[model samples]
Target: MTSTTDIKAIIRRHRTRDAAFAVLGMVCLLVCIATLMALLVDLAIDGVGRLSPGFLTSFPSRFPGKAGILSAWVGTILVMLVTALAAVPLGVAAGIYLEEYARKNWLTTIIEINIANLAGVPSIVYGLMALGLFVYQFHLGQSILTAGLTLALLILPIVIIATRESIRAIPGSIREAAYALGATKWQAIKHHVLPYSTGGILTGVIIGLSRAIGESAPLITIGALTFIAFLPPAPVQRTFPFVNFDWLASPFTVMPIQLFNWVSRPQQAFHLNAAAAGLVLMAMTLAMNGIAIYVRYHSRKRIKW
Candidate 1:
């Protein structure tokens, strides 16, 4: 029923809306890219001077000539490894149980809701909890062990959620087939289900660990000392009285904490050091994420079945 002029008007208006939407999207995308580029440029310009062999190897120092992040780097790696160890098994297991074992009951629903809520809770809150339990009540103090455990707790929900999602994405027919083959629940999971979900689980773990490694609020709250020049020594017995868990009582520092300290200082050199440390941390995180992506790509491409 429309005339030629009416049809033209409708078409013109539609084109205008499309154009506006496209422009808006492009503007948003460009803004994000520009922000990333600006930050990288700033970091490189400021931090390149501080990236030296000495910077990588020497322990932390109050004096610029002697300053380095060796201990902080070492402790950070150790804590991250320990955290991964604690988080992966439990997170993956919890995920697998939720996806494969748990029934759709009110109890499971409540647990799931709690986990989601926990993931959203502030990281510092977990640190405070660790402070109360491990530092005050049990007297574990603000040591590497307590810090690692606190981070573990902080990231556990994330890991569990990621793992559950990954496992759930697997087709149910696979499980049904395994069951039809007279496989028990554990056998089906161990032999068939797990192999299928390994890559997904690894990806989730890497992501969780990435988040944990950069976290400073919780670690700081747990009293990770800013200046601990000496490497954490291996536990030794002092047979004067009751046994003490020395690992849980020692002071520690980490990359993010050191970066925070350096950035807050008045000196420009400290600011430079903070940027260099930021670059290193970013590189480490990107490497972990890359590895996860590679695993996912290869695993998906090389399916045996």
Candidate 2:
């Protein structure tokens, strides 16, 4: 009877501890959400008045009232385009080679460890590296291409890690089934592995791009101008072939640099401009994440297992 009473006491204690932990987790989550909400509210309050069509279309000016993100946003888009073009394919290919084709060995193990470590390296390190390798050694100039490639290098590890993790999540049975059907390794991977992993891969890509979009350190190190009044040459042309690549070699500045420039000014109006730019940057990030969510949902729905 005494032993039974002791067991009951232990059960009650365990339940109480579990309840306490649950409450603690809830409080932490609420704290995070509340903090984020407060920041969004503050940004909105300070910047909403600046969000007009004219603000979107005008160029940066010495006067606060005339300054806009036209060049900044355009440069950002062009830089991101180059970044995506350079990083996505190479990162995905490297990931597939490592995860699917590489033999299990010490070298592979070392490579994996280094890749993971690279993902955690500081953004400034990449900036410094690019400054030497791209600007000095390769003579890529302080152009859009240099900035894009620099950001691509920054995010390559992230894409590779994400791709490997996504590919690893697929069940072995799927690959086995494909092999059992007399499919070659490449065919099986192309048909079974890739389709299932597309959502996760895209999520990683978007996440990398999101990070790339906000990065100013690498671009600045590579000589991104803080003040620019002109846009890059148009990527589209009226002539034959109808597409142009001259913009890739043009000078540029991104939104983060523009915001940094504004925030550094002594005028109160520029501070408001900075806040508005921050809101736009946040919106762009959220939009990219939203697309990732939508794609992931559909991809998961389409694939049962």
Candidate 3:
């Protein structure tokens, strides 16, 4: 319907405008990738020299000359694992209950709003909650348990949000099919919906864990001890027995916490150690993210629709 000259003019306009838009988008993406690459390169350059077995095996030292981060490394792992065990299941369960069982009423709406708000609340607030409840009221002291609980509280909203999203992403027809087949809500969710959503849920859990591991403020505010000569043996061997883990009651430090401590010290040795520790922290985090990406990739491949 258009003349050849008109069509060519339209095409020429689109060619210029579309080219500009594409170039803008590509430039933004390239900037982000370049920034990340720079960060990793800097970490490697600063830390590669100090990476060693002795660095990983030594305990907290009175002098920067003699210190290693073994105790802090172990403590970080213990705290993270315990928090994951507690928060992931509870958060996911709460999310499922809200999404599947709760009524569409004002009270439920309020609860959802509150949960969403809590997600945005600063980690320092969780720290205050831990200090008030675990230290002063419950007498758990400034132990690993206290820190884990604080971290759990800080990350619970994230876990719940992720879980709810994963569950919601499951097709409603699947649930309806189970219902039409004489299956109860529990049976449908248990045998079919949950299984289908498990991969997504796990992906969310791992991402939440990744965020939780890098948190330093909440732990510090909740009284994560900066120095501990001995690694916590377990949950029961700790001073606080009521919390189900003894490690919760003792003084402890994590890799991030130790790195922060080292960085604040005014010495070249501490600086080098901090860089090395930062390298370790980044490596662990990158490895976790890599695994999450791989899992998510494989998981998506298995989905039928």
Candidate 4:
């Protein structure tokens, strides 16, 4: 039989180790929170004053005091439009096919492995590929469409993985019940799978877009201009069609590139502009994440399962 002192010693050692780990985890969490708070505070101090209406409406100018993000933000919106339009349908469709329809085989296995690998591929590699495929071979030029397509490619794997995972989370019993009710496979997926997974899919899509928005490396490699004062042609026309597509082929710059331009300038005032632009970017990212969280929460609440 074990002595009472030995049992007490073992218990004391385990408790000591557990407390040490708890303290270590808390320290790491505090360090991360402190660093992020410090950066945000610094940005607010330097840039909050510059976020005025005029700053939003005006275009980039040589004079830092007069410069704004009109073109940058507009370009960002339009490019995001293209990215979503290109990525969502394709990614979702591919995911559905792989997860629901495709037979277990070598080909499917290879495709899955490749997609998982692609998700981790560096962004600059995508830029170079887009430069050759879209710009040279397709003659698309360094335009908004090219930029959008490049980012779409970069995030396609992310969307596909999210789609598959979300769909997989639904119980197989649900699908079987639909089938037992004489529902077609398509009907079951459409009526049940899609609705249940919409929240997760949207979260992934927005998260991917958020990452794409802040990326400057791929855009730069694809020849995005660093300085732009002119807006692309308006996407609405006053004529019979009442819609315009010229903006797709036009030159553009995003907020990150614009901020980079300002930061590169010698003047101290431009640094302030850079800080302001950084603030706006951070706000936009946060807003996207907030929307994702809100949607996910509501969606999960509605799911009885």
lDDT of 3 by residue, 75-169 (tens): 88888887898898899898899888999999999989999899889888888888888889999888877877778877888888878888898
Task: Write model 1 residue lDDT over 33-133, tens digit each, in one string.
Answer: 99999998898888878889999898878786568888788888878867887888888889888888899999999989999999899999999899999
The C-alpha RMSD in Å for every predicted model, in order, reads 3.6, 3.0, 4.1, 2.2
lDDT (Cα) of model 1? 0.85
Task: Note the clash tally of each candidate.
Answer: 0, 0, 6, 0
Top of the candidates by TM-score:
4
Residue 239, model 2, lDDT: 92
* Residue 164 CA displacement from its true place in model 1, Å: 1.4
Q: Per-residue error at 123 for model 2, in Å?
A: 0.5
Error of 2 at 269 (Å): 0.4
TM-score of each: 0.90, 0.90, 0.86, 0.93
Model 4 TM-score (2 dp): 0.93
Q: Tens digits of per-residue lDDT for model 2 on 77-153?
A: 99999999999999999999998999999999999999989888999889999999999999988999999999999
* Strongest candidate by lDDT: 4
lDDT of 4 at 256: 92
Worst 10 residues of 3 by lDDT: 235-244
- What digit string (tens of lDDT, one per residue) describes model 4 on residues 48-83? 989999998999998889999999999999999999
Error of 2 at 6 (Å): 14
